[model samples]
Target chain A: MREAKKQPGIAEVAAAAGVSVTTVSHVLSGRRPVSAATRALVETVIKELGYRPNPSARGLRTQRSESIALIVPDLTNPFYTLVAAGLQDVLMESGYLLSITDAAQPGRALPEVVRHVLARRVDGIVLASYGATDDDIASIAETGTKLVRLGSRFRADFGDVVRADDVGGMHDVVDHLLARGYRRIGLVNGEYDAQPSQMRLEGYTRALREAGRTADPDLIHFGTFSRAGGAAGARRLFDSAHPPDAIVGGNDLIAVGVMDAARERGLAIPRDVAITGYDDIEAASLVTPALTTVHNPAREIGRTCARMLLDRLAGKYDDVAREVVLAHRLVIRESS
Target chain B: MREAKKQPGIAEVAAAAGVSVTTVSHVLSGRRPVSAATRALVETVIKELGYRPNPSARGLRTQRSESIALIVPDLTNPFYTLVAAGLQDVLMESGYLLSITDAAQPGRALPEVVRHVLARRVDGIVLASYGATDDDIASIAETGTKLVRLGSRFRADFGDVVRADDVGGMHDVVDHLLARGYRRIGLVNGEYDAQPSQMRLEGYTRALREAGRTADPDLIHFGTFSRAGGAAGARRLFDSAHPPDAIVGGNDLIAVGVMDAARERGLAIPRDVAITGYDDIEAASLVTPALTTVHNPAREIGRTCARMLLDRLAGKYDDVAREVVLAHRLVIRESS
Candidate 1:
């Protein structure tokens, strides 16, 4: 390791500027009145020295944490984490730092989690998790901070929302499968009550109905939104007397799981059990037979959420909650 | 969506608690002295109403952002994003919000970024980007903020560093390939100047020498740490007059690219050409032949970085810098 040079201290910055330390502190923090010439001098010295105004001392003057909290289910998924990256891209530039937390685990109610972050007096909270309860929504409403929701499909809605048109995306997936001459198509979906789950299920049934085929409730299996969930759903379909020739996973992770199960059965993908999925994650293309799936702009959703929160922070929209539904498309690959 | 109720205002809390609004604000921000009884009363009402004191108003009293910035190249890669998530996990519980910034794009100097974020008055910065320049190191040294460098491998390092054992891990990969009867093994490495690339190259050549095989300089390909670089390297290898039967990618994305290139050439993985990768990301298992690679604990690295920064913030060790080297394991899978 290279030896680190000692950085200039606040006292050195004050001394270089030919001002009292208090004057320099006040000039940096904007807590007290100071002459414009003196302020400029202090700032120039700070710049030359690369001095960082003591954050704690400045916080007393600003009365703001200048931080935002992003609550997601987890970061294990590339999709969720990428969204976070996107949000950071926007917020970091705006001088507002974003902190992320996982609320997907079974314990720790959403309200409690939000309360814990709010206790820090963060400037904003972006609720990007799934199935936020009514109480959770109410708790978030208690704070005046800007709030933006990702996948806001719950019946009791609050906050600016960035949602995906998964319904249309799923319809396209089913249509593509139908066009490929695959009959007995099955669906691997998330929880029944989740907003995305219901919308996707509706699209799946609607696609079958539009093709002059009756929807088969038996063909639809609900599980958690995870790889294990998809694997279990595929197993249920395969073990049944009437196994579907094609399966559409709610997300890429689930589709990967389904593919794993099929491989264990020595089944050739696309040749035997054609699989499709939503959320065209990076793995969707890397997998053996690249998964045929719907491409949801997850990062874009994150960016939109951050922008909406920033707009709220800026009062650009003035109490008018904006609902943004991002676009999606069907991505064809080797799997289908 | 259910209609949201009107949340109680600060004035309501003050009225209910029988305290003045200034007292309530002071109690929340800790800016001014408040009587113990009055502070407790104000707190109870604030809890009952679930009120979040306006961040800006509170900032005047506290004078701190209470946030940290994490500078990473990009989160599109699961490896980088997972590390950010790990840091968030540790920082959130300590009442500190973590902000993330991307330092990976070409042309934008790293020091400029560190300075820009420093101007935001963030409490600290956890820099997780690779290949920091001397200017970047010097710029970081100019700030009083606590800074932790992730993946820093330079012999002369400044600041706390968290690194993985990629060198030993690469040696194991070469040995594994040699044991499998692959004599002509090629290495698709990253930037020659970077620490991991140099270390991995050393391990690869050392393993061949120890196994009584002459190391071939012609078989080494240096490229960027990306999938495209790997694909290009693979093409060069195949087009060579003497092509190796096995290739070791510096990282997983590179290996994935190699697989892509091989497939385009009508080559069957493991049968025609075996490929290995480092950094056993989630994609490693999801790929066609499942990439055989080194398992670097990315999340653990993030956690350790965060812990080190927190310890510094708490002054636990009284100004001594700590260097943490994380362990890596060889994951044997179908690719080899």
Candidate 2:
């Protein structure tokens, strides 16, 4: 390997800027405010010298990597990526590097993916799990890594939990469909075993019960949380003799698929069958006859997750795991 | 900061697995062949003990973080995310953590973002740059950091360059449109100064020249690579007294916007005006009248980039910078 030329250190930066090392430290950490002019001069000199505070060297002294790792089920999903975007916003502000790993991609088992990240020994972790077990959660905590779960399946005590109101959002959307005078509301949800799916199903049932009607088992179909999955479920519902007058998709991608299926079957939206979705992804608004869905604040949830993790790392919170639930609301659009 | 408990080490794994320390090391690194039965036993013990080869500890001894950083313009765009997905597939196989940062989001200036990541002292950097300068590229090399540029603006000697065949891809698409006998063609391209835009424009001109027709400056529009931007550009082209019979969107997102604009103006796709897009993003096929565009193979580009970086780090290749250009093809779909 070619030997790298000597890297400029804090002393070099201080010398170049004609300031004491303490002044340069203050400028870097922002723990103590320096004069604006001095700060600018120090920054300019640092840039001109191409000097960087080696994180590894700093980590050795502080016992902190100054980095956080996020493990998501899939990076391709818009919802997860939006959540990541939100997490990055806050973490970067605090000078923490965010490393994201997709658990589902490249066919790594959820447990193995978790273990792999744990080995990295990051300062903290924000796990947006899809199929992790209780054992997996316990293993992370055992390592004493600052743990925050996004849409967690375990109880609040397991870790700092940050999730949108999946159940309430689903309930409101179903209620809206009921108020629209659609009695037979067929629901196509995601994997039946997933936490979000179960929560959303509970909301669907609650809405039906409030209307003095029990949810028909035949009207609910569980599948993957994808457009193709939504289309497949829609097909099964439409092919039935007792097909409903309206359909509710578990998420925006599913709703888009339902729309596609409706078009394929020569069904005019809201004329032949009304549709509603959840998550309120970007495509939800862009699609024709804009989808009526629930506004799940994915980005806010991400920001909240990062803040919770940072609080623990900063010693602002105790060992007691906390739970935070962000509000979700109905987004009534043309589809319904 | 609460103190974390000491973690299980390789010795713990070795004791539990009934193997020597070297045997466990070989299993983790895969530097030598081990019997399948012993490998499985060692892995199970490692998982059971929750033993992780702490990267910080290993990094201290080996002077390697076993991590790579990817910097992109935006994470929300499907194209970049797909690239990240591809990069992750290879990096994970080599036991390297991938840290991705969006340079555009949260409104961080590009140079600042670059500087911020450089301080982390990662093993390598896969910079999918949008607006980085020659100085920015040079700074990375000066630090002895293994640098790979995805879609680099500079020549190959600056760093390893991995990109798709933007020029040839555009040329093929334009030629296809010409063969269909579309006399008047307008091009809605990305930012005027971007390398991709320049290369694509070159292809468009080359095709027009081959057809014995000089390109018209009035028919070209430059805007952001977004659906809204495409719509605005389309409006200008449509409002013209002599609007072109065909339009080429800079990317799939732009094409989708053009389609929306056409619908609002009561123009039928391919009937009233033919439309083509580049990139062939997921929405390209999902959109109504599926977009006829170029398949840029974003994931392949990402995989190739990771491979190139890894090869350099492994010392399999010399310090000389290399360039790899993957092929692009026209995906003829319903829109055209």
Candidate 3:
């Protein structure tokens, strides 16, 4: 493993630079000021010799892993992947490594997951769009791990929460559909228990009332937050005696499902049944008809979440219990 | 940080089980023979107390990090995310952690990335379709870092390689398209430099020749392995003086682009033009007029790649280089 010969140690660096060990340590650790010429000479030697500080040794001295864990519900979802990528971009810049875990799998106990991360002693954590029981949240908080919630707002008093404008974004999608002469619009929503699902539904109804359109409860269908769920709900809508002329999906996945349902039923998109989805995931544009949907700043949410966690770790815990709401927009395409 | 009381150690277990420290150590590490009754007693106490052997202590004694690095080209691609998830599933079971890195960013230095991973002293590495240059490979190999290539084959002496059945899968897709009575098929391909891209193109030409169909050079388009590239190629095909009746995308992203182009141009799928894609990613089904394409076990590929690296690390390197060729199948959907 040491084919290139052992890298020079700090002692060797100090000797080579003709400086005392104490002075070299002060210059390298930035503990005290050193002469400009001496500092430059030491830095040059360090760089030229390719000296890398041992992580284990530094970890022992700093009592920090210089790493963080990103816990998400699922990675198969493009939205989560994009968010994770965003988090990596910011965290990697600060010389911090990211360890990712998917909490969606069964049989892998959450407590064990927490313990494993704790054993690593990461400086912080970024939880992305995943639900945890109240007890779980309390346990994590009590463990003294700096936590930041992304997309899912929960236990406001426990940690920093970063989210997108889901309610407003949904309203934009619904209003756009109405403005496009789409009447009798059907809604394929997510699980009613989830916060995003309820908020989106509220936005949908608000937009309908503003348009002087009576909200039809029968036209609303709730299912899992997945493509299959959207397909199932869309099928039910199409089988109804009075099928809707257009469908509004809770997110891009559901909208994609709505598209699938229309195809299976031999319905022409935007002609026989216009469809709209939210989140504006990468798939939204790739799908046929390029789903007209709302663009949620997933990557930005991740960056903000990481920065919030970093701030907390830096002892800025009293920075108020604020919610960082990033901008979202409605991207009009062919679907609607 | 150690606020909780320290858990009982091996000495306490020996005291409780009425055994010597050596006997307990033998039973725990399976290093030496111990009476069955004594072994059972020690095991019971170990399980009852939920005692975990200290990984750091064990690592110190074994001279290993008990960790590995997984280098992928991109994580925004759902395919790679699934692969990462799969690799994590297997590695986590063995008490090994994964460090994931995305190498697709422009101006990203590979040597620095390799050095960073090596600095962490990861026990092995899994390079996923990264197209690593010879120098990069040589540098990592020189460090004695066990390496495995996923979704790409390397020189026989390079290391373990896991590749999908690209040629066979492409042939199946092209045959299905030709059987649908479509001629003048356009090939939307990925970077021509990639091995899979070249193999897939060969399959397409072979199928056309066997069907007594002339391959039109003008119908071939090459782009990056992304949905936008696919869409761009589809647009060019549509603008051509004579547009093809069908398009075969090298992968799912390109196929998605083709769908978007058709929708933008108001071309009815299958009626005006039929399209088929490869990979059959999760998006393939959710999109409107679900894509007809080939399915590659991306997650399985990742899992297999990790396993091979583990085997290599366990001193199982042999003269007969092991190669795992996973199966691929064509999935028919509404698009065709």
**What TM-score, computed on C-alpha atoms, does each candidate reach?**
0.86, 0.90, 0.85
Kindly provide the TM-score of model 1 when superposed on the true structure, using C-alpha atoms.
Answer: 0.86
User: Where is model 3 more than 4 Å wrong at Cα?
Assistant: A1-28, A34-38, A109-112, A177-186, A205-220, A236-247, A262-274, A318-322, B1-61, B107-112, B178-185, B206-217, B234-245, B261-274, B318-321, B334-336
**Backbone steric clashes in candidate 1, count:** 16
The CA lDDT at B322 in model 1 is 72
Lowest lDDT 10-mer window, candidate 1 chain B?
B55-64
Q: Kindly indicate the candidate among 1 and 2 with the higher lDDT.
A: 2
The reply for model 2, stretches above 4 Å from the true place, is A1-4, A9-51, B1-4, B9-50
lDDT of 2 at A82: 90
| Clash pairs for candidate 3 | none
Q: Best candidate, TM-score-wise?
A: 2
* Per-candidate alpha-carbon RMSD to the true structure: 4.9, 4.0, 4.2
Instruction: Tell me how each candidate scores on DockQ against the true complex.
Output: 0.35, 0.46, 0.32
lDDT of each: 0.80, 0.85, 0.79
lDDT of 3 by residue, A2-104 (tens): 1335546778888889998787778878989999999999989888876766555566456566678887777787888778777877776676777787766
* Best candidate, DockQ: 2
Clashing pairs in 2: none
lDDT of 2 by residue, A1-336 (tens): 244777898999999999998999899889998999999999999989877776766676677888899988878888888998899888887888899888776467678777777777788999887687878877787777888888755475577888888888889988898888998999998888788889899899999999999988888999988899999999999998898889999888888889889989999988889999998877777777888999889889989998998898888867777889899988999999
